[model samples]
Target: MAGSLVDVALPLPVYSTFTYSVEGPVPPAGTRVLVPFRREERIGWIVGAGSGAGLTRVRPILDILEGEPSVPPELLELSGWIADYYLAPLGMVLRTSLPSALSDSSRDYLTLVGKADDVGTPRERKLLAALGQGGAPRRVRTLRKALAMGSIWPEIRALATQGRICHQTVPPRDPPVRTHRVVRVMNWLSDLNDRENMFRRASRQREAYEALESSGGSAELAHLLHQGGFSRSVIRGLEDKGVVVLEDVEVLRDPFREEIRAEPKKLVPTRDQAAVLAALGEMLQEPNPPPALLHGVTGSGKTLVYIELLKEVVHNRNQGAIVLVPEIALTPQTVSRFRAHFGDDVAVLHSALSEGERFDAWRQLREGKKRIAVGARSAVFAPIPRLGAIVVDEEHDGSYKQSEGPRYQARDVAIVRAARVGALCLLGSATPSLESWQNAQIGKFRLFSLLNRVGGGALPPV
Candidate 1:
């Protein structure tokens, strides 16, 4: 509809979507919109649109925040399921799917409209004085602390009514995309022979070119120089000749920057591990496979089995996989192992990362730049394209249950999400949860078990 009415849900305690009018073109259902509500502006998600038949007067949506729908269609369905199944607030459930850094967090600040010399109350006058001294709008919280008032809303509201002050909401800031310099061999060069004449004249340039060619014909400028023992002049000269190209490419900011890179270890699976992996592989190929329960003992090498499966899912199938750990504290070790295996194809998601780091990581996964997502519970909701597998490590742990807001169980959500994308769900735990065990017992899930540890480490005599 060109100019129709839409229903939107605000992040409030309310249960129903409020109707609003659209003036020109209508945004898609999942786009965020700014609307005037109760004398203030509020951010809401557009759910659906219809003819405004029974309404007397409808307010027009103030602004469409994003050109594209912020929430994906699959997420919208998942949010609805969570709300219906858990009795959680629909708005809260939708909010949980977004990155916290991308939330509509705006703070109201006050600006003096006129002279604050004669304000209403003694406390109000003091608050105005503080605002006037700053010469700019001050956040409500800043005034509360400066004036030492427990609740300043009444005072602020009074000031607004007196026409002596103005209020505005400051939108949250998004982190900037990071970029780095890179070098690539020019296509015209074709082969080493094409550079033979130039190589004789400039030995250093030849060395740099050969180094880049050896490393797949592209590399970071800094890395190329370091590996070739060449100077910037050599690179510049090659660039001037059009033999090589230099450009800046956007790169994600890694949160664990100081951590040294670990090498992916090779392992030979035991007979039991091999048999189980084969069964799991068969399920992965099915069009609509059932969820799987991986039951193993404490010393069993379940993590290594997951690593092997992910390697095949990502490298062979060119698909994505998500690994969910139970705790934020466990993310670093888990992330390091995945990165060691998948290198740049792995992205980490968790609460412990800075807002920028998390945003960048999420972007990489969404844009198909990264193929594997690893972290705690929230990682289950990662925007993985063409998802092939989902691994819930420590599925029996209680930390996978979100205790606040939406109160969703990440393990359950992972299974549903995998089904939505035609991916295989693997719930691995030393002591399997009763729910998963029951599912395996009833044939809802395929069951596999790891019986012993690697390296023949015998258990203690008990």
Candidate 2:
């Protein structure tokens, strides 16, 4: 049996994970634990389980808040690695990984949902009445100056504690908590017989037990079972052991896809296209294959090739693909080409979508509402499971690099994401980036060269 305590890292201005007790109820690592932070109860993102320090003084968590942890441990682990590698704070890394809403949970007075009445308390009523008598929801800052409440947070908290009026954080717009029904395997850590059973279990069961063992305690079900695909019962049993845990961190989805389906299309490939596609296809089938650079000159039907391969991958129904283009290329004409063939099966993520629209689009991909996602840089994070391939049009385009915030280069990041997800890559460009050209010459990627247009249109004044 695993220990009953854990350390959870809340993504905040701080950098460390807070240690808390989970003896009575075994919540998963990604659970959002409402701990007694400082003097107030605050929500902290959970990292993993640990033995709560009994040797030293510590406060128990206020309550394991309802809902699943939104962030996955693997993502948390990866984000932590990125923060460390880039010399960034873990909390800042969490901030970037999380949505814009989680950091700010405060609320304001507004027209209550479905009702117009001021549903606030006396203090809140005072503010709301003032807003009602004068005009509308006043900025708390301005309200503080006008109402002389000193600091509104306390009053807001008190008023909020009553549920009389709505605060800025009435209900989290992008709630970080996702409801996850998890079952964990339980073991008698105190029983010597349990250790013997673990060693002699069936191969599949033993493999799972061993993997969890390697995890040092808590492991995400999806990740730990990726190899042999363990049963939910097994997970439950582990939880019984107080080892396998489940919680909801922020659940981030591929901001582009809403469903998973093969929006395959037939490709009218030229002879060059046919040959190159076959060759690259073969290359992708190899073990540990590198990215492929398809030097399809401008108007060389690279899009057609994309359709062909995507059709093939979807036809298999076991994997999916992502098509990345320059953000500017998502203009109507460019976007239309893929949509004309794929129809509603394609989801595009770009700057055009409102925050709500963007979140919904991302949710669609995350929920598997859309399968194939195409967009600018951020689209690289599409949530499609079992990604089979990725096609980067105009791989050399400078717009692929993101300059702010995460400061990650899309083309490079796509390569990393593809490798992590076992997806094949096709980098097509008329004027290839010098780096790509160099990679091609060195045999780092299979290079397919396209020379002429399919058929002559004007005959060049011959």
Candidate 3:
């Protein structure tokens, strides 16, 4: 609620968000804006509002890119928590939440575009020859490291314009193939009932056939190939035999979000579950809850306990809760639990998603349409803005520790995250991590042990 000049935190590893001035109007917090740091461009988050006083040497913001705030205030706070606790730069923490496209990053590349021959001088011509041989594009940095030269963006742009062989910034990716394969006998299947090998071949094809058949018609080629075990030659053989058919498959643009409709069954909480729920609820209502530990054996009603608490938390505020599970939580069986309790309000985020799918989940988090995000390590950043509480199921699982890049432990990060915005942090696990157990025993954290299994089930011996 200040002015047009503000400090933003980028998600880049560069340590911090460079300050930028807004010409038109200052963006509200959580808005995604582009800022320039030297020659590189960056997408960053506005964590704080500005006062527009003594803001000098600040370049104008490139753009206020997001129509709605792509992140929530609570998430921004969580990013700060990750940066501090993980010993990461604030910008780098934010970067983990962004999609590649939003970052608009292009690696410097060296290209050849002259007469394919006028590459200039022996060294330049040799590099040009390598470019003309053209199996794949090389980054200019890679080219420079090999060539041991200086900044080359200008020369590369010139080469692109001259068509001597063009140089352009490109994302690193494996070359894609334009070839196609026949997966099934779409049109011929119903007609060719009596052909030779028809029964046996079609018998094997039955799985693929049924898969395509089950798609309610028009399944993607990849789905068919993977599901049916039909290779290019097999599909071609089928095509030649006039069995099933194959068609050009367009890429699925929208990331797939399973529309899970779960009916909340009449849940009968065990005494232990009831006690833990009561203890956690009381803790959440306080000024700051000592991290609540739910130590239940596997098969104990940890999830049921979460559902009851979430139901209470969401109904009381405009914000919602985040259910942090290991990446394995995305499995069909586990998702069904949250789906049953929260239904469509659950947003799933994980690395298994395509870039577009991640964007979609981020979009959902932005719009406040999704109140519950069940995801792996990265879901800790799920854009739930008002984040009232976080339930880290299996809180001790090592899967919560990210090994590469910003290697922040999800459980630890979630604690700092909850602490930032005064949210209740509950870690529920049958087998508590030694760190959590030690922390609890020493009174660093308040712990709740649920020894009884829900629904009269026996607690697994652990």
Model 3, residue 267: what's the lDDT?
74
* Model 2, span 107-126: residue lDDT tens: 34532222225555566666
lDDT of each structure? 0.82, 0.64, 0.70
Each candidate structure's TM-score, on Cα atoms with residue i matched to residue i, is 0.79, 0.61, 0.68
> Model 3: runs farther than 4 Å from truth?
1-12, 16-22, 28-31, 35-40, 45-61, 106-114, 130-151, 157-262, 316-318, 442-444, 454-462
Model 2 lDDT, full chain set: 0.64
Residues 113-146, candidate 1, lDDT per residue (tens digit)?
8766963779888878888885888888777887
1-462 in candidate 3: lDDT tens per residue? 223667788766666556667776667787877667665565677777555555556677776776666566666777777777778887677777665556655465554544467545555565666666664677666776766656554555555666665555443232122344434445535544454346574555555555656765455566556755666565565556665667664232333344546676897888777887888778878877778888886677788888889988887665678888888666967777777877767777777776766666666665777888788878777767677898898887889888876878888878887887788888998889898999999998898887665555774455
lDDT of 2 at 81: 63
Which 10-residue span in candidate 2 carries the lowest summed lDDT? Answer: 107-116
**What lDDT score is found at residue 149 in candidate 2?**
69
Q: Once model 3 is optimally superposed onto the true structure by TM-score, how far is the C-alpha of residue 323 displaced, in angstroms? A: 0.7
